[model samples]
Target: MIGQISEASPEAPYLAANLYLDPAVISALLIEMSDMREPPLDTGFRISKADPELLDVWRRLIGLLDRPDEVPVMAHHFEHELMFRLLQGPQGALLRQIAGTDSRLSNVRRAMRWIREHFAEHLSIEVMATIAGMSVSVFHRHFKAVTSLAPLQYQKHVRLTEARRRLVSEHDAAATVGFSVGYESASQFSREYKRLFGASPRRDADMVQTIVDPGP
Candidate 1:
């Protein structure tokens, strides 16, 4: 998956929250709740305003952080309830596909996993298609439709993103980081890295380091 950028006013406090849904948990909930003949979801991503009920559920779940002892006893219940609320919301179709064993989204996820695992290697569309259990044509269309990126583009994203992380965390030289992420030409790597990140790898690494560990 790719990262999204967010902006906040300098004078305002920014709060962001994310919940990771386990497919296994969703599947279990589907079994206990109403029938799940949900329609196929085309896009793997969606943005919807949270209903009041869903917001309340999140509030209670986050509240448990202040009551750590109650977490062991009530966390599971809150999680299950959260999923139940999500299952009843506009993103229900997306949630359903994640739990479906043989869905287009799941199939695409299969290929995506392979790409992330082998990001530094040469990418083969045929191999990715096989992993997704779809023909190359169908796989390409669905993959792009779901992720808004072609397969190769996704791999490049994975590579450059990984390269940036390594540059900062591993403190590797720009050339070495580029090569480690599958670029044969340092110029090509620097060009693309700048295009994506708005700075050369070395410069970006330095900027991030300055922000993370400003000297006394």
Candidate 2:
């Protein structure tokens, strides 16, 4: 779900710690905890400032890295505590939906996976609706509500995102990359690419390349 992640600073280098939550682990904990479920959230993602208890759990979890031998035994426990603390936070509702198999957020995520996989193909709203197991109108409404983008609009975002990656990493021609991403007209691709990225494809790639490999 994370397309890109980075940290930048003018003085000291940026430093942070992160964790990956296992849905199985979360679901197991949910079984023991009663009345933890909440109404479905329009969006699955949530952000909250970590409180002291959550920070303490994070610290203990990070400490495991230093004691590699203990990690095999204790890491899972710490991860569970971490998720438990999170489930008690403001983000709890969103996390609960993530663990629900039939939640609307899950259905939307299913469709999102499909879009990411078939982004270069012609987008079919009907197919996306079916994938989400909703009628066309219902799917469109829910998709937009959850993701803030219509189906075709989401496809455009996926296409442009991928085009950026291919341009930067593969150094392919803009037109070729555009065609490969289902854009029929090179000019249309360039125009939209600029609209989204604030620069033409080649220019943005060059800019990124400059940042990546600055010469002496």
Candidate 3:
């Protein structure tokens, strides 16, 4: 997102950029998708092939990135068109769940958000279930179905992922970072860390450092 200029493509080398799209646009799209009552559309997990029309529309939107002065006025309009196209596409129903208050997916999403904010805290499945407004058994099933992880397993994953980021970038002590992320025992942290990342934290950190800071 920063820097003078960079190109991304599917050709020789690929580059990726993080785009922070306006949440308001996504919310509006979700609402539009969910409100349709005529026989629901087939909501595929992903679109296997690109639609020519949508692809052209996307190209037009991406063109605006080169025109900084016009982006403020033109971005919202482009986003609206893109949202409409998505609502008419195969993933429409999947996108609708993102904005639905009554949907079980929405409830699970709320719980996921809470877990992210308090990943280092002692998490209770019962408490998470209460947050999602479902009984423990029901919430557990739906949550696992949605995320492919049990609640505590999800927390451990989040904790370890965060620990890896801090360890790689900040060179924090493995034991200290482990406790900071919520594990009480350093040995437990090391065991889980190795299991997930395939290396001790120290080794992983060194490997990352070598990749990012290779010097003459």
RMSD of each: 2.8, 2.4, 4.8
lDDT of 2 by residue, 13-62 (tens): 66567677677887898988887546856765556799999999988888
lDDT of 2: 0.86
Identify the runs in model 3 with alpha carbons over 4 angstroms from their true place. Answer: 1-14, 17-47
For candidate 3, the per-residue lDDT at 55 reads 78
Clashes of 3: 0
Whole-model alpha-carbon lDDT for candidate 3: 0.77
- TM-score winner, 1 or 3: 1
- Candidate 1: residue pairs that collide: none
- TM-score for all models, in order of appearance: 0.89, 0.89, 0.81
Query: What lDDT score belongs to each candidate, Candidate 1 first?
Result: 0.90, 0.86, 0.77
Give the clash count for model 2: 0
Candidate 1, residue 148: Cα displacement in angstroms equals 0.5
Q: Candidate 2 — which residues are off by over 4 angstroms?
A: 1-13, 16-18
Please report how far candidate 2 places residue 177 from its true position, in Å.
1.1
